[model samples]
Target chain A: MQQDAARLKVTREGDIVQVEFTSRKILDEGNIAEIGDQLSVLVEAEHRPRLIISFAGVDHLSSAALGTLITINNKVKNRDGQLRLCNISPQIYEVFLITKLNTLFHIYPTVKEALESLRSGSQAGRLK
Target chain B: MKHLKLQAGPRGQRQSREKSVGLWCTEEFPSEMSEGRRVEEKILSQCRKHAYGQRDLFALKLALEEAISNAIRHGNKCTPGKNVRVKYRITRQRVDVMVEDEGHGFDPAVLPDPTADENLQRTCGRGVLLMRAYMNNVVFSPAGNSVTLTKFNESSSSSDTPLSTTTVAFG
Candidate 1:
Protein backbone atom coordinates (compact mmCIF):
# COMPACT_ATOMS: atom_id res chain seq x y z
CA MET A 1 0.00 0.00 0.00
CA GLN A 2 1.56 3.28 -1.12
CA GLN A 3 -0.75 4.89 1.48
CA ASP A 4 1.14 3.20 4.30
CA ALA A 5 3.51 6.14 4.00
CA ALA A 6 0.66 8.68 4.18
CA ARG A 7 -1.14 9.69 7.35
CA LEU A 8 -3.87 12.12 6.17
CA LYS A 9 -6.58 12.27 3.53
CA VAL A 10 -7.17 15.92 2.74
CA THR A 11 -10.02 17.52 0.80
CA ARG A 12 -11.09 21.06 0.06
CA GLU A 13 -14.39 22.93 -0.04
CA GLY A 14 -13.44 26.28 -1.48
CA ASP A 15 -11.12 27.90 1.08
CA ILE A 16 -12.11 25.63 3.93
CA VAL A 17 -10.02 22.45 3.80
CA GLN A 18 -11.05 19.21 5.47
CA VAL A 19 -8.50 16.77 6.88
CA GLU A 20 -9.00 13.10 7.77
CA PHE A 21 -6.69 10.43 9.15
CA THR A 22 -5.74 7.47 7.01
CA SER A 23 -4.61 5.51 10.05
CA ARG A 24 -6.43 4.60 13.25
CA LYS A 25 -3.62 5.75 15.51
CA ILE A 26 -1.77 9.10 15.87
CA LEU A 27 0.83 7.91 18.39
CA ASP A 28 3.97 8.14 16.26
CA GLU A 29 6.14 11.28 16.28
CA GLY A 30 7.31 11.11 12.66
CA ASN A 31 3.77 10.68 11.37
CA ILE A 32 2.46 13.50 13.51
CA ALA A 33 5.23 15.81 12.28
CA GLU A 34 4.37 15.06 8.66
CA ILE A 35 0.68 15.67 9.32
CA GLY A 36 1.58 18.97 10.96
CA ASP A 37 3.72 20.04 8.01
CA GLN A 38 1.03 19.14 5.49
CA LEU A 39 -1.57 21.20 7.34
CA SER A 40 0.83 24.08 7.87
CA VAL A 41 1.29 24.50 4.12
CA LEU A 42 -2.49 24.68 3.68
CA VAL A 43 -2.85 27.27 6.44
CA GLU A 44 -0.07 29.40 5.00
CA ALA A 45 -1.57 29.40 1.51
CA GLU A 46 -4.70 31.21 2.64
CA HIS A 47 -5.03 34.72 4.05
CA ARG A 48 -7.45 33.36 6.63
CA PRO A 49 -7.26 29.61 6.75
CA ARG A 50 -10.49 27.79 7.52
CA LEU A 51 -9.53 24.27 8.58
CA ILE A 52 -11.68 21.34 9.71
CA ILE A 53 -9.95 18.19 10.99
CA SER A 54 -12.40 15.29 11.29
CA PHE A 55 -11.31 12.42 13.52
CA ALA A 56 -14.00 10.15 12.12
CA GLY A 57 -12.41 6.72 12.44
CA VAL A 58 -9.39 7.46 14.61
CA ASP A 59 -9.13 5.20 17.67
CA HIS A 60 -5.95 6.21 19.51
CA LEU A 61 -4.14 9.55 19.78
CA SER A 62 -1.34 10.67 22.09
CA SER A 63 -0.17 13.85 23.84
CA ALA A 64 2.25 14.46 20.96
CA ALA A 65 -0.73 14.62 18.63
CA LEU A 66 -2.40 17.08 20.97
CA GLY A 67 0.69 19.26 20.94
CA THR A 68 0.73 19.36 17.16
CA LEU A 69 -2.93 20.42 17.11
CA ILE A 70 -2.17 23.18 19.55
CA THR A 71 0.57 24.39 17.25
CA ILE A 72 -1.81 24.34 14.30
CA ASN A 73 -4.42 26.22 16.30
CA ASN A 74 -1.86 28.87 17.08
CA LYS A 75 -0.91 29.20 13.40
CA VAL A 76 -4.57 29.62 12.38
CA LYS A 77 -5.36 32.12 15.13
CA ASN A 78 -2.36 34.24 14.25
CA ARG A 79 -3.85 34.79 10.79
CA ASP A 80 -7.32 35.37 12.27
CA GLY A 81 -8.38 32.05 10.70
CA GLN A 82 -10.74 29.50 12.17
CA LEU A 83 -10.02 25.84 12.98
CA ARG A 84 -12.67 23.23 13.79
CA LEU A 85 -12.28 19.65 15.06
CA CYS A 86 -15.10 17.19 14.60
CA ASN A 87 -16.27 13.57 14.93
CA ILE A 88 -13.88 12.67 17.74
CA SER A 89 -14.60 9.29 19.32
CA PRO A 90 -15.86 9.36 22.91
CA GLN A 91 -12.64 7.81 24.19
CA ILE A 92 -10.49 10.40 22.41
CA TYR A 93 -12.90 13.10 23.54
CA GLU A 94 -12.10 12.13 27.11
CA VAL A 95 -8.48 12.82 26.31
CA PHE A 96 -9.37 16.36 25.28
CA LEU A 97 -11.64 16.71 28.29
CA ILE A 98 -9.00 15.51 30.74
CA THR A 99 -6.48 17.94 29.25
CA LYS A 100 -9.15 20.71 29.32
CA LEU A 101 -8.39 21.28 25.62
CA ASN A 102 -12.10 21.06 24.94
CA THR A 103 -12.43 24.61 26.20
CA LEU A 104 -9.68 25.95 23.99
CA PHE A 105 -10.78 24.27 20.76
CA HIS A 106 -13.88 24.71 18.61
CA ILE A 107 -15.12 21.12 18.56
CA TYR A 108 -18.23 20.00 16.73
CA PRO A 109 -20.06 16.71 16.51
CA THR A 110 -20.02 16.60 12.71
CA VAL A 111 -18.38 18.14 9.67
CA LYS A 112 -21.71 19.69 8.69
CA GLU A 113 -21.90 21.67 11.93
CA ALA A 114 -18.26 22.72 11.72
CA LEU A 115 -18.85 23.94 8.16
CA GLU A 116 -22.02 25.78 9.17
CA SER A 117 -20.30 27.50 12.07
CA LEU A 118 -17.15 28.37 10.15
CA ARG A 119 -19.21 29.85 7.30
CA SER A 120 -21.18 32.18 9.56
CA GLY A 121 -18.72 32.62 12.46
CA SER A 122 -21.44 31.10 14.64
CA GLN A 123 -20.54 29.32 17.89
CA ALA A 124 -23.17 26.63 17.39
CA GLY A 125 -22.65 22.92 18.11
CA ARG A 126 -19.61 23.54 20.27
CA LEU A 127 -18.94 20.92 22.92
CA LYS A 128 -19.87 22.13 26.42
CA MET B 1 4.49 -20.07 47.11
CA LYS B 2 2.49 -17.41 45.22
CA HIS B 3 4.32 -18.19 41.99
CA LEU B 4 3.42 -21.86 42.32
CA LYS B 5 -0.27 -20.98 42.71
CA LEU B 6 -0.32 -18.66 39.69
CA GLN B 7 1.25 -21.33 37.54
CA ALA B 8 -1.62 -23.66 38.39
CA GLY B 9 -4.17 -21.96 36.09
CA PRO B 10 -4.66 -21.18 32.42
CA ARG B 11 -4.30 -17.77 30.80
CA GLY B 12 -6.52 -15.13 32.37
CA GLN B 13 -6.83 -17.28 35.50
CA ARG B 14 -8.92 -15.47 38.06
CA GLN B 15 -8.18 -15.48 41.79
CA SER B 16 -9.81 -12.49 43.50
CA ARG B 17 -11.35 -9.07 42.83
CA GLU B 18 -8.34 -7.19 44.13
CA LYS B 19 -5.44 -9.04 42.43
CA SER B 20 -3.98 -12.04 40.59
CA VAL B 21 -0.92 -12.78 38.46
CA GLY B 22 -1.13 -13.79 34.81
CA LEU B 23 1.03 -14.22 31.70
CA TRP B 24 4.07 -11.99 31.70
CA CYS B 25 7.19 -11.22 29.63
CA THR B 26 10.17 -8.91 29.78
CA GLU B 27 12.32 -7.70 26.88
CA GLU B 28 14.73 -4.93 25.95
CA PHE B 29 14.79 -3.08 22.68
CA PRO B 30 16.90 -0.38 21.13
CA SER B 31 15.87 3.26 21.66
CA GLU B 32 13.69 3.47 18.62
CA MET B 33 10.04 4.31 17.95
CA SER B 34 9.47 1.24 15.79
CA GLU B 35 10.58 -1.04 18.60
CA GLY B 36 8.22 0.80 20.92
CA ARG B 37 5.37 0.12 18.51
CA ARG B 38 6.30 -3.55 18.39
CA VAL B 39 6.07 -3.97 22.15
CA GLU B 40 2.78 -2.08 22.21
CA GLU B 41 1.32 -4.53 19.72
CA LYS B 42 2.65 -7.56 21.58
CA ILE B 43 1.05 -6.42 24.85
CA LEU B 44 -2.23 -5.38 23.25
CA SER B 45 -2.45 -8.73 21.51
CA GLN B 46 -2.31 -10.49 24.86
CA CYS B 47 -4.96 -8.15 26.22
CA ARG B 48 -7.18 -9.07 23.30
CA LYS B 49 -6.53 -12.79 23.89
CA HIS B 50 -7.63 -12.38 27.49
CA ALA B 51 -10.88 -10.85 26.23
CA TYR B 52 -10.28 -7.40 27.64
CA GLY B 53 -12.95 -4.92 26.60
CA GLN B 54 -12.42 -2.24 23.99
CA ARG B 55 -12.28 0.44 26.67
CA ASP B 56 -9.51 -1.32 28.59
CA LEU B 57 -7.61 -1.95 25.39
CA PHE B 58 -7.81 1.70 24.45
CA ALA B 59 -6.61 2.85 27.87
CA LEU B 60 -3.77 0.38 27.99
CA LYS B 61 -2.68 1.28 24.50
CA LEU B 62 -2.66 4.98 25.23
CA ALA B 63 -0.80 4.59 28.50
CA LEU B 64 1.77 2.33 26.91
CA GLU B 65 2.37 4.75 24.06
CA GLU B 66 2.87 7.67 26.41
CA ALA B 67 5.08 5.85 28.87
CA ILE B 68 7.30 4.39 26.18
CA SER B 69 7.57 7.64 24.25
CA ASN B 70 8.59 9.43 27.42
CA ALA B 71 11.27 6.85 28.06
CA ILE B 72 12.64 7.22 24.57
CA ARG B 73 12.39 10.98 24.26
CA HIS B 74 12.54 12.54 27.69
CA GLY B 75 14.39 9.94 29.74
CA ASN B 76 16.79 8.59 27.15
CA LYS B 77 17.04 11.87 25.26
CA CYS B 78 17.31 9.84 22.07
CA THR B 79 20.84 8.94 23.01
CA PRO B 80 22.55 6.44 20.75
CA GLY B 81 22.87 2.87 22.02
CA LYS B 82 20.50 3.56 24.91
CA ASN B 83 17.83 0.93 25.34
CA VAL B 84 14.26 0.75 26.59
CA ARG B 85 13.24 -2.10 28.89
CA VAL B 86 9.62 -3.19 29.06
CA LYS B 87 8.05 -5.58 31.56
CA TYR B 88 4.36 -6.39 31.45
CA ARG B 89 1.95 -8.81 33.14
CA ILE B 90 -1.48 -9.28 31.61
CA THR B 91 -4.51 -10.87 33.30
CA ARG B 92 -8.20 -10.90 32.62
CA GLN B 93 -8.73 -8.66 35.63
CA ARG B 94 -5.87 -6.23 35.14
CA VAL B 95 -2.65 -5.38 33.29
CA ASP B 96 0.54 -3.93 34.70
CA VAL B 97 3.34 -2.48 32.53
CA MET B 98 6.67 -0.96 33.36
CA VAL B 99 8.94 0.98 30.98
CA GLU B 100 12.45 2.03 31.87
CA ASP B 101 15.00 4.08 29.93
CA GLU B 102 18.79 4.01 30.11
CA GLY B 103 19.36 7.73 30.61
CA HIS B 104 19.16 9.78 33.76
CA GLY B 105 15.66 10.69 34.95
CA PHE B 106 13.94 13.97 35.54
CA ASP B 107 11.56 15.13 38.28
CA PRO B 108 7.91 14.95 37.25
CA ALA B 109 6.52 17.16 40.03
CA VAL B 110 8.11 20.36 38.76
CA LEU B 111 6.39 19.93 35.40
CA PRO B 112 4.08 22.80 34.54
CA ASP B 113 0.32 22.22 34.46
CA PRO B 114 -0.47 21.71 30.81
CA THR B 115 -4.17 22.38 31.38
CA ALA B 116 -3.60 25.79 32.84
CA ASP B 117 -4.98 28.81 30.98
CA GLU B 118 -1.52 30.09 30.18
CA ASN B 119 -0.50 26.74 28.70
CA LEU B 120 -3.56 26.29 26.50
CA GLN B 121 -1.69 27.04 23.28
CA ARG B 122 1.47 25.20 24.28
CA THR B 123 2.31 22.02 22.37
CA CYS B 124 3.32 19.61 25.16
CA GLY B 125 3.41 18.45 28.82
CA ARG B 126 0.20 16.41 28.72
CA GLY B 127 1.43 12.78 28.46
CA VAL B 128 1.74 12.23 32.19
CA LEU B 129 -1.70 13.70 32.74
CA LEU B 130 -3.24 11.23 30.30
CA MET B 131 -1.43 8.24 31.81
CA ARG B 132 -2.86 9.13 35.23
CA ALA B 133 -6.34 9.74 33.86
CA TYR B 134 -6.71 6.45 31.97
CA MET B 135 -4.79 4.08 34.23
CA ASN B 136 -5.83 2.96 37.72
CA ASN B 137 -2.35 3.63 39.04
CA VAL B 138 0.94 5.21 37.79
CA VAL B 139 4.15 4.89 39.72
CA PHE B 140 7.49 6.46 38.78
CA SER B 141 10.91 5.35 39.94
CA PRO B 142 12.81 7.47 42.41
CA ALA B 143 15.07 8.69 39.63
CA GLY B 144 12.03 9.18 37.34
CA ASN B 145 13.61 7.19 34.51
CA SER B 146 10.89 4.56 34.64
CA VAL B 147 7.10 4.41 35.08
CA THR B 148 4.68 1.60 35.83
CA LEU B 149 1.12 1.81 34.53
CA THR B 150 -1.69 -0.33 35.98
CA LYS B 151 -5.13 -0.70 34.46
CA PHE B 152 -7.99 -2.89 35.70
CA ASN B 153 -10.27 -4.25 33.01
CA GLU B 154 -13.80 -2.98 33.57
CA SER B 155 -15.34 -6.10 32.00
CA SER B 156 -13.14 -8.53 33.91
CA SER B 157 -15.45 -9.15 36.84
CA SER B 158 -18.36 -7.20 38.27
CA SER B 159 -16.75 -7.10 41.69
CA ASP B 160 -13.26 -6.15 40.39
CA THR B 161 -13.80 -2.42 40.13
CA PRO B 162 -10.84 -0.20 39.35
CA LEU B 163 -9.47 1.84 42.19
CA SER B 164 -9.33 5.62 41.95
CA THR B 165 -6.47 6.76 39.70
CA THR B 166 -3.40 7.66 41.69
CA THR B 167 0.27 8.56 41.02
CA VAL B 168 2.88 7.25 43.42
CA ALA B 169 6.41 8.69 43.32
CA PHE B 170 9.25 7.01 45.09
CA GLY B 171 10.95 9.34 47.52
Candidate 2:
Protein backbone atom coordinates (compact mmCIF):
# COMPACT_ATOMS: atom_id res chain seq x y z
CA MET A 1 0.00 0.00 0.00
CA GLN A 2 1.15 3.52 -0.82
CA GLN A 3 -0.01 6.85 0.62
CA ASP A 4 0.93 10.52 0.49
CA ALA A 5 0.07 13.45 2.72
CA ALA A 6 1.21 17.01 3.25
CA ARG A 7 4.20 15.99 5.35
CA LEU A 8 4.37 12.22 5.04
CA LYS A 9 5.26 10.24 1.93
CA VAL A 10 4.60 6.52 2.08
CA THR A 11 5.94 4.07 -0.48
CA ARG A 12 6.21 0.32 -0.60
CA GLU A 13 9.48 -1.55 -0.63
CA GLY A 14 8.76 -5.25 -1.02
CA ASP A 15 6.70 -6.22 2.03
CA ILE A 16 7.98 -3.27 4.05
CA VAL A 17 6.29 0.12 3.72
CA GLN A 18 8.69 3.05 3.96
CA VAL A 19 7.16 6.22 5.34
CA GLU A 20 9.30 9.32 5.00
CA PHE A 21 8.41 12.67 6.47
CA THR A 22 9.20 15.63 4.23
CA SER A 23 9.17 18.27 6.93
CA ARG A 24 12.21 19.35 8.93
CA LYS A 25 10.01 20.27 11.89
CA ILE A 26 7.38 17.69 12.78
CA LEU A 27 5.97 19.35 15.91
CA ASP A 28 2.98 21.13 14.45
CA GLU A 29 -0.41 19.76 15.48
CA GLY A 30 -1.71 19.62 11.91
CA ASN A 31 1.29 17.60 10.84
CA ILE A 32 0.64 15.17 13.68
CA ALA A 33 -2.96 14.58 12.58
CA GLU A 34 -1.97 14.11 8.96
CA ILE A 35 0.68 11.55 9.89
CA GLY A 36 -1.68 9.63 12.18
CA ASP A 37 -4.39 9.51 9.53
CA GLN A 38 -2.01 8.31 6.85
CA LEU A 39 -0.39 5.67 9.05
CA SER A 40 -3.76 4.51 10.32
CA VAL A 41 -4.80 3.75 6.78
CA LEU A 42 -1.74 1.51 6.43
CA VAL A 43 -2.24 -0.40 9.69
CA GLU A 44 -5.96 -0.99 9.19
CA ALA A 45 -5.45 -2.53 5.77
CA GLU A 46 -6.24 -6.19 5.10
CA HIS A 47 -2.65 -7.50 5.10
CA ARG A 48 -0.25 -7.45 8.02
CA PRO A 49 2.41 -4.83 7.28
CA ARG A 50 6.04 -4.21 8.18
CA LEU A 51 6.82 -0.50 8.30
CA ILE A 52 9.84 1.78 8.53
CA ILE A 53 9.70 5.51 9.15
CA SER A 54 12.64 7.53 7.80
CA PHE A 55 13.46 10.70 9.70
CA ALA A 56 16.24 11.96 7.44
CA GLY A 57 14.62 15.34 7.06
CA VAL A 58 13.27 15.74 10.55
CA ASP A 59 15.56 17.91 12.67
CA HIS A 60 13.13 18.83 15.42
CA LEU A 61 10.55 16.60 17.04
CA SER A 62 8.07 17.24 19.85
CA SER A 63 6.16 15.04 22.24
CA ALA A 64 3.24 15.15 19.84
CA ALA A 65 5.42 13.50 17.25
CA LEU A 66 6.55 10.90 19.76
CA GLY A 67 2.92 10.32 20.74
CA THR A 68 1.99 9.81 17.12
CA LEU A 69 4.76 7.23 16.78
CA ILE A 70 3.54 5.37 19.84
CA THR A 71 -0.03 5.36 18.55
CA ILE A 72 1.10 4.09 15.18
CA ASN A 73 3.27 1.44 16.78
CA ASN A 74 0.31 0.17 18.74
CA LYS A 75 -1.94 0.07 15.71
CA VAL A 76 0.68 -1.84 13.77
CA LYS A 77 1.12 -4.29 16.61
CA ASN A 78 -2.61 -4.84 16.93
CA ARG A 79 -2.60 -6.05 13.34
CA ASP A 80 0.42 -8.32 13.96
CA GLY A 81 2.69 -6.06 11.98
CA GLN A 82 6.06 -4.49 12.81
CA LEU A 83 7.39 -0.94 12.84
CA ARG A 84 10.93 0.42 12.81
CA LEU A 85 12.52 3.88 12.68
CA CYS A 86 15.70 5.01 10.95
CA ASN A 87 17.82 8.02 9.92
CA ILE A 88 17.09 10.01 13.06
CA SER A 89 19.48 12.81 13.94
CA PRO A 90 21.42 12.79 17.21
CA GLN A 91 19.36 15.58 18.70
CA ILE A 92 16.10 13.84 17.84
CA TYR A 93 17.56 10.58 19.08
CA GLU A 94 18.21 12.21 22.46
CA VAL A 95 14.51 12.98 22.81
CA PHE A 96 13.67 9.34 22.19
CA LEU A 97 16.21 8.32 24.81
CA ILE A 98 15.03 10.89 27.36
CA THR A 99 11.47 9.61 27.07
CA LYS A 100 12.69 5.99 27.02
CA LEU A 101 10.88 5.48 23.72
CA ASN A 102 14.03 3.93 22.34
CA THR A 103 12.97 0.86 24.27
CA LEU A 104 9.55 0.70 22.66
CA PHE A 105 10.45 1.11 18.98
CA HIS A 106 12.99 -0.74 16.89
CA ILE A 107 15.49 1.84 15.65
CA TYR A 108 18.12 1.36 12.96
CA PRO A 109 20.99 3.62 12.09
CA THR A 110 20.06 3.81 8.42
CA VAL A 111 17.18 2.99 6.12
CA LYS A 112 19.33 0.46 4.29
CA GLU A 113 20.03 -1.44 7.49
CA ALA A 114 16.40 -1.36 8.50
CA LEU A 115 15.31 -2.72 5.14
CA GLU A 116 17.96 -5.38 5.23
CA SER A 117 16.90 -6.54 8.68
CA LEU A 118 13.31 -6.69 7.59
CA ARG A 119 14.20 -8.53 4.39
CA SER A 120 16.36 -11.03 6.19
CA GLY A 121 13.49 -11.73 8.59
CA SER A 122 15.78 -11.31 11.58
CA GLN A 123 14.50 -9.32 14.54
CA ALA A 124 17.88 -9.32 16.34
CA GLY A 125 19.63 -6.01 17.09
CA ARG A 126 16.60 -4.10 15.80
CA LEU A 127 15.37 -3.17 19.26
CA LYS A 128 17.95 -2.48 21.94
CA MET B 1 8.65 43.29 19.22
CA LYS B 2 11.34 40.65 19.60
CA HIS B 3 11.91 39.24 23.09
CA LEU B 4 15.72 39.65 23.12
CA LYS B 5 18.26 42.33 22.29
CA LEU B 6 22.10 42.22 22.46
CA GLN B 7 24.55 45.11 22.49
CA ALA B 8 28.34 44.86 22.38
CA GLY B 9 31.28 47.24 21.85
CA PRO B 10 33.66 47.25 18.88
CA ARG B 11 35.88 44.21 18.41
CA GLY B 12 39.19 46.09 18.62
CA GLN B 13 38.58 47.67 22.03
CA ARG B 14 41.47 45.51 23.45
CA GLN B 15 39.44 45.01 26.66
CA SER B 16 36.77 42.35 26.89
CA ARG B 17 33.38 43.80 27.77
CA GLU B 18 30.42 41.73 28.86
CA LYS B 19 27.20 42.40 26.95
CA SER B 20 23.88 41.64 28.57
CA VAL B 21 20.45 41.99 27.06
CA GLY B 22 17.25 41.01 28.80
CA LEU B 23 13.89 40.82 27.11
CA TRP B 24 10.42 39.79 28.23
CA CYS B 25 7.08 39.65 26.46
CA THR B 26 3.56 38.64 27.37
CA GLU B 27 1.15 37.85 24.56
CA GLU B 28 -2.27 36.23 24.48
CA PHE B 29 -2.86 33.81 21.62
CA PRO B 30 -6.05 32.16 20.51
CA SER B 31 -6.44 28.53 21.46
CA GLU B 32 -5.39 27.13 18.11
CA MET B 33 -2.65 24.79 16.91
CA SER B 34 -1.38 27.31 14.37
CA GLU B 35 -0.98 29.98 17.00
CA GLY B 36 1.13 27.67 19.13
CA ARG B 37 3.41 26.92 16.19
CA ARG B 38 3.88 30.61 15.49
CA VAL B 39 4.92 31.25 19.06
CA GLU B 40 7.40 28.37 18.87
CA GLU B 41 9.03 29.73 15.74
CA LYS B 42 9.37 33.19 17.25
CA ILE B 43 11.00 31.81 20.36
CA LEU B 44 13.33 29.53 18.41
CA SER B 45 14.62 32.32 16.18
CA GLN B 46 15.44 34.39 19.23
CA CYS B 47 17.27 31.45 20.76
CA ARG B 48 19.33 30.91 17.61
CA LYS B 49 20.35 34.58 17.47
CA HIS B 50 21.54 34.30 21.06
CA ALA B 51 24.01 31.58 19.94
CA TYR B 52 22.48 28.55 21.61
CA GLY B 53 24.08 25.26 20.59
CA GLN B 54 22.19 22.94 18.28
CA ARG B 55 21.31 20.45 20.99
CA ASP B 56 20.24 23.13 23.43
CA LEU B 57 18.18 24.85 20.75
CA PHE B 58 16.46 21.62 19.86
CA ALA B 59 15.64 20.86 23.48
CA LEU B 60 14.31 24.34 24.18
CA LYS B 61 12.23 24.40 21.02
CA LEU B 62 10.71 21.00 21.68
CA ALA B 63 9.95 21.77 25.33
CA LEU B 64 8.45 25.14 24.49
CA GLU B 65 6.28 23.66 21.78
CA GLU B 66 4.97 20.96 24.10
CA ALA B 67 4.11 23.47 26.81
CA ILE B 68 2.26 25.77 24.42
CA SER B 69 0.32 22.96 22.82
CA ASN B 70 -0.65 21.55 26.19
CA ALA B 71 -2.00 24.93 27.21
CA ILE B 72 -3.99 25.35 24.03
CA ARG B 73 -5.29 21.82 23.75
CA HIS B 74 -5.73 20.35 27.23
CA GLY B 75 -5.83 23.48 29.35
CA ASN B 76 -8.11 25.59 27.13
CA LYS B 77 -9.75 22.58 25.50
CA CYS B 78 -9.42 24.36 22.18
CA THR B 79 -12.17 26.75 23.11
CA PRO B 80 -12.55 29.40 20.42
CA GLY B 81 -12.84 32.31 22.81
CA LYS B 82 -10.14 31.11 25.15
CA ASN B 83 -6.64 32.48 25.02
CA VAL B 84 -3.26 31.28 26.28
CA ARG B 85 -0.79 33.73 27.71
CA VAL B 86 2.95 33.21 27.14
CA LYS B 87 5.66 35.16 28.90
CA TYR B 88 9.32 34.58 28.06
CA ARG B 89 12.61 36.19 29.00
CA ILE B 90 15.97 35.73 27.28
CA THR B 91 19.22 36.97 28.70
CA ARG B 92 22.92 36.44 28.10
CA GLN B 93 23.06 33.52 30.51
CA ARG B 94 19.73 31.75 30.34
CA VAL B 95 16.22 31.45 28.93
CA ASP B 96 13.04 31.45 31.00
CA VAL B 97 9.57 30.73 29.66
CA MET B 98 6.11 30.66 31.21
CA VAL B 99 2.78 29.61 29.71
CA GLU B 100 -0.65 30.18 31.25
CA ASP B 101 -4.11 29.12 30.14
CA GLU B 102 -7.52 30.41 31.13
CA GLY B 103 -8.77 27.11 32.43
CA HIS B 104 -9.00 25.18 35.66
CA GLY B 105 -5.74 23.39 36.36
CA PHE B 106 -5.10 19.80 37.35
CA ASP B 107 -2.77 18.30 39.92
CA PRO B 108 0.68 17.63 38.48
CA ALA B 109 1.29 14.86 40.95
CA VAL B 110 -1.47 12.76 39.40
CA LEU B 111 0.12 12.56 35.98
CA PRO B 112 1.10 9.12 34.78
CA ASP B 113 4.68 8.15 34.06
CA PRO B 114 5.06 7.80 30.34
CA THR B 115 8.12 5.62 30.65
CA ALA B 116 6.27 2.95 32.60
CA ASP B 117 5.88 -0.40 30.86
CA GLU B 118 2.09 -0.23 30.60
CA ASN B 119 2.20 3.41 29.47
CA LEU B 120 5.10 3.12 27.04
CA GLN B 121 2.81 2.41 24.10
CA ARG B 122 0.42 5.17 25.07
CA THR B 123 0.32 8.52 23.27
CA CYS B 124 -1.03 11.37 25.40
CA GLY B 125 1.21 11.40 28.47
CA ARG B 126 4.61 12.09 26.92
CA GLY B 127 4.24 15.88 26.75
CA VAL B 128 4.86 16.44 30.43
CA LEU B 129 7.73 13.98 30.38
CA LEU B 130 9.47 15.73 27.53
CA MET B 131 9.06 19.13 29.17
CA ARG B 132 10.63 17.93 32.38
CA ALA B 133 13.46 16.07 30.68
CA TYR B 134 14.50 18.90 28.42
CA MET B 135 14.19 21.88 30.72
CA ASN B 136 16.44 22.30 33.73
CA ASN B 137 13.49 23.26 35.90
CA VAL B 138 9.81 22.65 35.21
CA VAL B 139 7.47 24.14 37.80
CA PHE B 140 3.71 24.45 37.66
CA SER B 141 1.56 26.96 39.46
CA PRO B 142 -0.34 25.77 42.51
CA ALA B 143 -3.52 25.65 40.48
CA GLY B 144 -1.64 23.99 37.54
CA ASN B 145 -2.93 26.55 35.05
CA SER B 146 0.57 27.83 34.36
CA VAL B 147 4.08 26.33 33.91
CA THR B 148 7.53 27.83 34.11
CA LEU B 149 10.51 26.29 32.29
CA THR B 150 14.14 27.25 32.75
CA LYS B 151 17.22 26.21 30.75
CA PHE B 152 20.66 27.32 31.83
CA ASN B 153 23.13 28.17 29.10
CA GLU B 154 26.14 25.89 29.28
CA SER B 155 28.19 28.54 27.51
CA SER B 156 27.38 31.14 30.11
CA SER B 157 29.24 31.88 33.32
CA SER B 158 30.59 28.93 35.26
CA SER B 159 28.98 29.99 38.52
CA ASP B 160 26.13 27.75 39.69
CA THR B 161 23.84 30.75 40.25
CA PRO B 162 20.78 30.94 38.06
CA LEU B 163 20.45 34.07 35.93
CA SER B 164 16.89 34.82 36.94
CA THR B 165 14.11 33.27 38.96
CA THR B 166 10.40 34.06 39.21
CA THR B 167 7.88 32.87 41.75
CA VAL B 168 4.46 32.05 40.36
CA ALA B 169 1.56 32.96 42.60
CA PHE B 170 -0.47 29.95 43.69
CA GLY B 171 -4.21 30.05 44.21
CA lDDT of every candidate: 0.83, 0.79
Q: In candidate 1, which residue pairs get closer than 3 Å at backbone N, Cα or C atoms, i.e. clash?
A: none
Q: What are the runs in model 1 whose C-alpha is more than 4 Å off?
A: A1-5, A26-30, B1-19, B159-171
Q: TM-score chain B for all models.
A: 0.82, 0.79
Q: Which ten residues in a row have the lowest lDDT in candidate 1 chain B?
A: B1-10
lDDT of 1 by residue, B39-76 (tens): 99999999899888999888888889899989988888
lDDT of 1 by residue, A30-126 (tens): 4788788877887888899999999998888888989989899999999999999999989889999999999999999999999999999899889
lDDT of 2 by residue, B55-117 (tens): 778778878888888898899999999999999987645788999999899788999888888
Encode model 2's per-residue lDDT on A1-128: one tens digit a residue: 67676767888877788988877766455577777887788778737879899999788777887888888888888888888899988878888888888998889988888998888877656645
DockQ of all models, two decimals each: 0.73, 0.70
Best by TM-score: 1
Interface RMSDs of the predictions, in order, are 1.3, 1.3
TM-score for each model:
0.87, 0.84
**Could you tell me the C-alpha RMSD of candidate 2 in Å?**
6.9
